[model samples]
Target chain A: MSDIPADLRYTKSHEWVRTEEDGSLTIGITAHAQELLGDLVFVETPEIGAVFAPGDDCTVVESVKAASDVYCPVSGEVTEINEALEDSPQIINEDAYGAGWLFKLQPSDAPEMDELMDADAYQAHVDEEDH
Target chain B: MGNKTPLYAAHVEFDGKMVDFGGWDMPLHYGSQVDEHHVVRQDAGMFDVSHMTVVDLRGAGAKAFLSNLLANDIARLKDAGKAMYSCMLQDDGGVIDDLIVYYMTDDWYRMVVNAATRVKDMAWINKQSAAFDVEVTERPELAMIAVQGPSARERAVPLLPEDLREPSSALKPFFAAENGEWFVGRTGYTGEDGFEVVMPEASAASFWKALFDAGVKPCGLGARDTLRLEAGMNLYGSDMDETISPLEAGLNWTVAWEPAERDFIGRKAIEAQKAEGKARKFVGLILQGRGVIRNHQAVNVGDETGEVTSGGFSPTLQASIAFARVPATIGDECTVDIRGKGVPAKVVRPPFVRNGKSCID
Candidate 1:
């Protein structure tokens, strides 16, 4: 089974959002998402200060197999991007939820968090995909 | 789910990520494909290649039959255990399949063909062999393992039966030797010093375990593809197929035109194409941008457009590379369509990396 932390919220497309104490939100792909992509070789993170609507393709992650787009789970402006991934994308494969976080976003509507799937729902979604 | 190879259970036991490939459940990678590719280049690695079909042709008319069946002349394999890489062609000069034929004896020749083309290849060979009095027998009970790298032989030889070790070690590239039930051939797709051992299916699992214990990392199809591409080897279905002729697929050298009296299956069409000089050029491309190139990408060359047959990130070269078919008038530079944008690329002679080193500047 893939790691699905109960504290994090997720989208059907596999992006995870962690609400920060300061009202900002941190976003990254789920461990299940990284597992399917295999080892990541390259990452093109969204630009800091860029605005994105919910479900927008905000980043790109490439593996040895193929390239994939990372969707934004909620409408927000990118406050900070993970610059470390520019040098070593494998960090995402190593720690998908921690240092591998893609970006920090200041949400336009904090209520959108309720729209995302909780840990149990996301696990069920991943299980459905496997079957 | 698909048909399983003899090593299916072994792959799962080794934590291989299994995927469906050409109707077979095969490992795509153990962990990291890039790591597996480097292991074959810098050290030793092994792959379960039992999904490939092995056909044995035995009869007095075997040699005569192959001469007509394959584009390359099997008569060139005069010495016993010598092998020849050839294309089985259709009458129109299009490739049926690219295969390696080994001459084991006066009346026995062995062939290994792509896994995906098994059904059609068997039917075609059977149809052609009816008139030659040759018996075409599919060897489904055989399992093949390719151990490759600079140190591959050094690591693999110790595991073989006592008497077979010496001969297997002394085997030259493109040559094979029989020891008991094992047919050990000194050939590999990774452009490294190695052996492709064909043995009985029942013993495959144990042999794989032994090789793993000997420090030979188990590789998967993912690495196999990258290694072969880096070595500039053409893939059967991707590089050439029923619609693509060997002449346009960088395999003209494999065709034998000597002994003018010899008429192979596709000789007439190939001869006509050679005379016309309208054949498209096949060349290698090195991407000058950050994105990965993929199959069927449009290649804009001069005024005409072409297609990329195979394309991926070369873990060896640390750059994106591809094989493309373009107009004969194409020059040193071209643009490949990555997504919607055109990415510039430099054209170069293939065998991009050979002997674990980059062949390009």
Candidate 2:
């Protein structure tokens, strides 16, 4: 199983959200998500200042053969996106939870985090999908 | 579970991620496909190609039957152990399958065809050989391994049969030397200098282990596809199928049209198509900017629209490249409709990479 930090929250689509001190949210795909899509060759992050609804495709991650979209977990405007992913998208494969964080957002609804699954619940969800 | 190759267990032990390819369960990758691609490009890598079909034909009519059966003339194979790549075409000029046939003798010839087309290939071979004296035999008990890279031949040469080792090591491209059940072909799809070894099924895992110990990394079908794409090799179903003619698929050289006396299955239709003209052209595409190029993308070459038959990110080129069947009037520039965006691409000759070097600027 992939790592699921207890402090963060995750969505069924596999994006993990962590609220910042100033009430903004830091969002990225979970480690489990990166494992499913091997060795990302290209990453297309959402435009800065663009608005997105929950479950919207905010980023496109690609391997050599296939491309997958990264869904947003909460409604927000993309305040920042990981510039490091532009040239070296493999960072997501190396460290999905840390430097591979896709974008920072100012969430419109703070209560959306409650609807997302906790670490234990997300682990169980991943386990159920495995079988 | 699907059809398993003799080396399936070894693939699992080597951390291969198994996926169902056609009807067979095969390795997609051991770990990272990109890493494996680099290994094959720089050092050496081995692939379990045992899932590919192997056929042996014997009898006095072997050469004559193949001359009529394949689009390319096997008469070009004058010497023993010389191999020829040809397309088995339907009577209507459509491709049945692309295969490599090696001339062992006037009475004995060996062929290796794609694994997915085994059933129809066997049925077709049997149906066609009924009029000739050739005995078509499917050798399912044989396993094939492709060890490829600049240094791959030296590493595999030591493990081959002692009697055939020296000769096999010195084999020219598109040639195979054999001893007993072992057939070593100096050919590969990866656009690298390598050896394709065919051996008994029972000894597959052991052979794979020996190569692994010799530092030849095990690569999976994922890396295989990317490698072939970078090399600009045409895949059977993807590049050309039963509905597509080899001429339209950019394989004019593979068709031996000289010597009007040599009549093959698809010769008439092919001639008619050539006379009619306006045939579609097959060419390579290199994406101008970011984003991956994928198959089935509609290509806009000026006013004419075509489609990408095979496309992917080329790890060697660090850019996305594709193969497209376009109108004969296609110029240097084309636009690929990728996810509603018109991504511009350069129309160039096939073979985007070769011999561990990028062929394109």
Best by TM-score: 2
lDDT of 1 by residue, B1-361 (tens): 7999899999999999999999999999998898999999999999999999999999999999999999999999999999999999999999999999999998999999999999999999999999997999999999999999988999999988777799998899999998648889999999899999999999899989999899999999999999999899999999999998899999989999998889999999999998999659999999997777888999998778999999998988988899999898888999999878899999998989998999999
Taking all chains together, each candidate's TM-score versus the true structure is 0.97, 0.98
lDDT tens digits, residues A1-131, model 1?
88999999999999999999999999999999999998787788888889999989999898888889999999999999999997778899999999999999999998999999999999999999999
For candidate 2, the per-residue lDDT at B253 reads 86
lDDT of 2 by residue, B191-280 (tens): 999999999998888989999999999999989999998898999999999999988898888999987899999999998998898459
C-alpha RMSD in Å of predicted model 2 compared with the true structure: 1.0
- Across residues A1-131, which tens digit of lDDT does each residue of candidate 2 receive? 68899999999888999988899998888899888888789998999999999888989989865889889898989999899999989898899889999999999887877999999999999999999
* Top candidate, metric lDDT: 1
Candidates' DockQ values? 0.63, 0.84
**Candidate 2: misplaced stretches above 4 Å?**
none
Worst 10 residues of 2 chain B by lDDT: B270-279
Task: Give stretches of model 1 more than 4 Å off.
Answer: none
Docking quality tier of model 2: high
